[model samples]
Target: MNRRRLTRWLTVLLMSTSNLLALPALAADEAANALITRLSTEVLGSIKASASVRTGDVTTIIALVDATVMPHMNFKRMTASAVGPAWRQATPEQQKRLQDEFKTLLVRTYAGAVAQVADLSVVVMPLRASPQDKEVVVRTEIKGRGDPVQLDYRLERTSGDGAGWKIYNLNVMGVWLVETYRSQFAQEVNTKGIDGLIATLADRNKVNASKG
Candidate 1:
């Protein structure tokens, strides 16, 4: 090839390489932002659509969560993190039980709170993460009466048959959900052990259910 042609070709090749390197980061950023916005819209829409849900009915909210929220959440990971080191020692059966109770506690607890705030609009904050990051926090504000409530989600990009981003943890008003629960679970595990933690969750869920 001519000298000019060769230089142009090399420049084009360099540009293409740069773009290729940036694609993963761009893709991850867009995909994660879209996912968070979509999930928030869907949950809010469902809550607004159902009067029973707006009334803070746990049963209705449970249905909504199972249908809309649970699919995107990595509750197993959240539970394991919450349970801390005790999780490693627990049998499979115990783990399952812990997951069940933990799920119930979360659903019942937030179900009522979110139901009450169904009318509020969620504004997604700018996502601050690099292209190489597999896990990121998507921050948002729930706008309604009083100050805007801070709601943030920690999501991880996973690969496999169903490869995509999954939400594993949450933060409300600067307090991280898993970390908050971890402290309680750790205390329980320290004194009461794994079964004790499970029992505590189960009891809390039961009380919340009765209140609901």
Candidate 2:
């Protein structure tokens, strides 16, 4: 696989390995590492036991993403960040469509790589954030393949009951996921406007669905 494809594969693998959305009310570092340690084994085991996942069944993978992955991810923030300044200009209905299409685009883009996550394990690195900090970067390494891939998560604390750290951005290798998408989305918005960008994502999702 090319570098981009490999990165995407690794991103999906790392993200799928842990449940970041509903972590316990602990220190950010503690919560991040604990979730990784606790869930990685179970997630990997499920993938190994499921023939559908190993064979890249799109429907199964999409369902898995929705059920297990989306809850923990702050996709509204992710979508807004990727949309940049144009997000403010988008109507509520347009914003909803954008988020939905963008979510589908991501689910379809990396869902096939679910099968590639064999014998992979994550080791959460030491945290270097002050307790008062609202946002922090949780670093980790995915071992058991070739060289360990450095994966990092940018999490922000949320307020209210049952609130905990939620992941808004991810880093695979040295690239941040939201920034990567932002560049692409910016181009679409500049040429086609917000609706155009939404249509573009919908079209891409349709093509991916057909291939599946």
Q: Per-residue CA lDDT of candidate 1, range 103-192, in tens?
A: 777667655554454556778887898867899988887676767666677889877534567678767667776887789899999999
TM-score of each: 0.79, 0.88
Positional deviation of residue 40's Cα in model 1 after best superposition, in angstroms: 2.0
Find the candidate with the highest TM-score and give its number. Answer: 2
What clash pairs does model 2 have? 21-72
lDDT of 2 by residue, 1-212 (tens): 45677676776665665433344455344555555555665677777888987777878877777776766667899999999999999999999999999888887788788777767777878778877778888888878757887778888876675466667887888889889999999999999999899999999999999988
Give candidate 2 regions above 4 Å deviation.
18-30
* Highest-scoring model, lDDT: 2
